[model samples]
Target: MSSYLLILLLYVFDQAFGESQLKLVTVLYRHGDRSPVRAYPTDPYQESAWPQGFGQLTQEGMRQHFELGQFLRKRYTGFLSEPYTRYEIAVRSTDFDRTLMSAESNLAGLYPPNGTQVFYPGLNWQPIPIHTVPQDEERLLSFPLSNCPNYIRLMNETEKTAIFLNMTKTYGDFLEMVRNKTGLESTSIESIWSIHDTLFCEEKHGMTPPDWVTPEVMSTLQLLKNFGFQIMFGVYKREEKSRLQGGLLLDQIIRNFSAAASVNPSGPLKMIMYSAHDTTIVALQEALHVFNGVQPPYASCHIFELHQDNESFSVEMFYRNDSSVAEPYPLTLPGCAQRCPLQDFIRLTRSVIPTDWDKECTVNTHSSDTDVIIGLAVCGCVLLLLVMLLFIVLCRQSEPSIGYSHVINQSDDHS
Candidate 1:
């Protein structure tokens, strides 16, 4: 019994205390706050009201990302080079005005121009390319991708579950009122989130929301918005949803670990930085089973650190949502330790990773189903017509029998 207790103690201590040399770091963060994408039909503050138009990053958002970048700079002081180098880090963003601008703002703070590399004496910033693909082509960083019809079908099925049905039943009246007020044709818990977002953004920008958007209304809308996130990533059939959605990003991140491990020391790609939306954060975390069940705040980040002690490698995760905290909170992967072995991490996460994304998204929509049924029906009608003709032609025996032999290949040629 004493030996058993000792073993348990050692196992617990081992899981808790093995911080080591950091080999690689990957940071994914939500783009800073911006204006709402668009306003409801009845909204007084339309797209024209915003200076740079809807969905553009605001001055505050720029400050938020810049500060976040500085926070990262200070946090990884000795690990990262003082000057920016393309070999050391790669920055990727979804192709959106706000996200792209946020990445630029972040880079401004992360790597300010200095030394001989400075192009102009007065300019403190250097131009670093932030890579992006078109929205339709983006798979690595975007969340809740629309290309998967099976995912849509899954979501539709999920909506029929008791929890979602109860939510709808509970909020039916409230949703109706919102639809009427916003002049929207219809409203659901999922759609009402946009109303909350518009009001929240206006409030964040120091504009008073209309009286219809009361404190209570905003609070309830916030619940629905969070619930909507849950539905996309986790309210039910969570792992199945992850396989279709978040697992793609997770797979890319895992492969990045292998890439980072293979790179030569002379030109190491030490970090990968991704700037995207709040949904991006939620989806990745959901894949990892570490989501905190809320909308990740603007500029919030999730960090993946690949650590090495001699030949063995381990993975560590940290989440930074609170600006007040000096250090981000560590996240332990379920069924693994805080400093989880790379192999174990991969093994544990294998269930969620998709083997064939396109195949998984492909529903059993037999393209030839209708054609086959129609063909069978037509064949039956022809057979019935032939029987009627045979009855009529029986009176003219020999001619009809010869015609039947011509029609029946079995009689003409046995082979």
Candidate 2:
């Protein structure tokens, strides 16, 4: 009886705890650093300011991502099939020159094509496809400064919120004080957004920033930049949330691999790479409940690793900030079971998964003329009731002669 009881207990534990194993992986990351795409007036880094010219990757940025790719290759060496099958990995990038080049450089280090695929006979390097959508169609990937009416209303409402009221006032005061202290016209808000772009360009080429930008000032600006990210992701207008924080495309990519892995059970995409902008990484991480409120440094990667035990699956999260560092910073998915089950993981992700922005979900294109006719029928009934009430009131006012006739009949009967 004791043995039977023990077996029953073990089964119950298994059911409660989940299978604890599954193998599938998905990763999303911003592209490595590059020069300023455009320069504003009073900026130090302008066109012709860098060695490689504007909107090009810096040497340091290249090395950072190359190291990241190498780290990924080492991390999944045994798990991935040899020779890096096309079906085994996918890399995508935003359609900027810097991002495209960053993707290429990252691939150079990640899968450096080898063996039969090397057509050059001696060299292993080969071109890999990095998919991208045009900038205008990139509403999902980019945090557009929405000029919509509802969004403006939300922003105004945010200003009235206590947190925003305090922060904006303090930051505005800081900007005013800085202008007075430095004798510069640039406000803190403008400097904060464009500083990284400025210094990146100056450092890339052989230019120098003016003495007004102290190291402390730069640090403050960086913090403000992070604040901006937090506002954009968590504090933005309600209607624009899906378009801004949506990660459905990324989730779909993972689901596709998980499906393949379920059927084949041996080989699926071991790694997926996204070389995009800082905003791209920030948007996705926020949706995933892992945002750090700052622009991810050059080559910063959010890694999603999967494991399997028997029939069940689990996923682990890791963030690597520095490429030179070997270990990834461990992170947990919020509201996940310990060793979260694959199906549960999908469910949690679905809560934050963005709906299709281009397709108006509220629109009923099929219900047109017939629906309008039905609406008019309902309106007609209301109109008829109102008209009947008016007619009754007019008839009562016009019937005093009928009351007189009744009185006359009563008098005739008495006589």
lDDT of 2 by residue, 45-105 (tens): 4587667777788777787777777787788777666575787777777778878888877
Give me candidate 2's TM-score against the actual structure: 0.73
lDDT of residue 76 for candidate 1:
90
Q: On residues 228-326, what C-alpha lDDT tens digit does candidate 1 reach at each position?
A: 988898878888889989999999888887665553443577789999999999989999999998999989999999988656778999999988889
What C-alpha lDDT do the candidate models reach, one value each? 0.89, 0.67
| Span of ten consecutive residues with least summed lDDT in model 1 | 398-407
Q: List the residue pairs that clash in candidate 1.
A: none
Q: What is the C-alpha RMSD of each candidate to the true structure, in Å?
A: 9.2, 10.5
Each prediction's TM-score versus the true structure: 0.86, 0.73
